[model samples]
Target: MNQLKLTVSILATAGLLFFIAACAQMGTLPSLPASHPEALAIGQQVNCAECHEDQQKGTLKPYKAFNHSPVFVKSHRFYAASDDRLCSTCHKSSFCNDCHTNKVQIKPSTKFGNRPDREMQHRGNFMTMHKIEGKLDPASCYRCHGRANNERCIQCHR
Candidate 1:
């Protein structure tokens, strides 16, 4: 009975110590802010490096990763997929949904035409260009056209 009581007391003390350590560690963990401290201009191009040359706090990636350069914009899908928590800092979920939804209501080319940096697959004169592009990369065409606008492609692709 004494041995069991000692074991129980040790376990209770160990649990209390673990709980205290966890509470102390919680304060050291990184946390994201609700919103940016500064207001960004609407529709203006964002260059994270312009303001933050160093690595952003609480994020694994450097500010350069978030820059809106042509290369970054063109390959944003990969970056966004890898760690979208960093993306939520500056952009709303809707910002990505605008361009990435399965059934695109408005072609990005039309919706964000003013922003030429964005790479829209079927931009101006796509009808004329698709024949050559399709031959080069048929998979790209099938990805979106396979389901979204099957009727249009079926008329000719079949």
Candidate 2:
């Protein structure tokens, strides 16, 4: 009976320690700030590696992951979709809205004409490319033009 009581006490103590540790971890949970501390220069390309050498604090993704290399500029959608919370820390929703939203008044290629380093859709002779691209991945076209600008597309497609 004494051995049984000791075993029960040990189990109870172990469970209590685990619960406390979990609660402590929860109390000190890591979270990102709502915005960057300082305003970044307009049109000045940032090099994150210059300032930050370590991986991101809460998440272990490398700081270089945020760099706007041509590869990153082209494939940013996948990264954004994976964790837009990380993107929001550095960029305002309006930054993405400029391209992704229906409110865009000017074409992205025209608006970012000065920023040749940044990739924009329909950059050069898209009419020729779209014929091939549309056949390869019609869903890609539908993402932008399906509901919003189908009228413009139907004018040509139909």
Candidate 3:
């Protein structure tokens, strides 16, 4: 009977350690900044830079500053607008995208030694086409668009 009790206590201790490790991996719990009350009243109109003065340049400023806020982190789980739409609610998309696009360059490059011979190159565009013939799954779109109460199919299709 004593051996069974010892085994149960060991299992319980292991379970507690597992829970703490999982939470740590998920990330730190958000904290409410002292300025939260003043910032909250302004609604979405508050300029992030007004409080995050040091973040005049990179994506880290908005990400770290807002993630620390109780409001931003809580709402982030329900919607995918925290970075751009949240700020763009007051700022323009062009202002944000100009810096963002440059930061996230999407240029495709040919792999070295993998290029086709010049004489064998086709006259038209040489872009490689990948044909995925299968019944497309709609569930993938739900990762972002599925959560919002107002999201429409046209938002992505159009």
- The clash tally of candidate 3 reads 0
TM-score of 2: 0.64
Residue-pair clash count for candidate 2: 0
Residue pairs clashing in model 2 are none
CA error at residue 126 for candidate 1, angstroms: 1.7
Q: What does the lDDT come to for candidate 3? A: 0.42
User: Candidate 1: how many backbone clashes?
Assistant: 0
Per-candidate TM equals 0.62, 0.64, 0.22
Off by over 4 Å in 1: 1-27, 56-59, 113-119, 138-158
Order of all candidates by TM-score, from best down to worst?
A: 2, 1, 3
| Candidate 1 colliding pairs | none
Residues 1-158 of candidate 1: C-alpha lDDT, one tens digit per residue: 99999999999999999999999999888876667778887666578888888866764678777777778877787788786877787889878766555556666788888986656667888778888998999876554444555455657867
Top candidate, metric TM-score = 2
lDDT of 2 by residue, 45-95 (tens): 566676777656765578777776667777788889877997898888877
Candidate 1's displacement at residue 100, Å, is 1.7
lDDT of 3 by residue, 1-158 (tens): 99999999999999999998988876655433333344244324334556656554433344345542557534543434534544444446553332223232221222212333311111233223111211254443243234433423234445
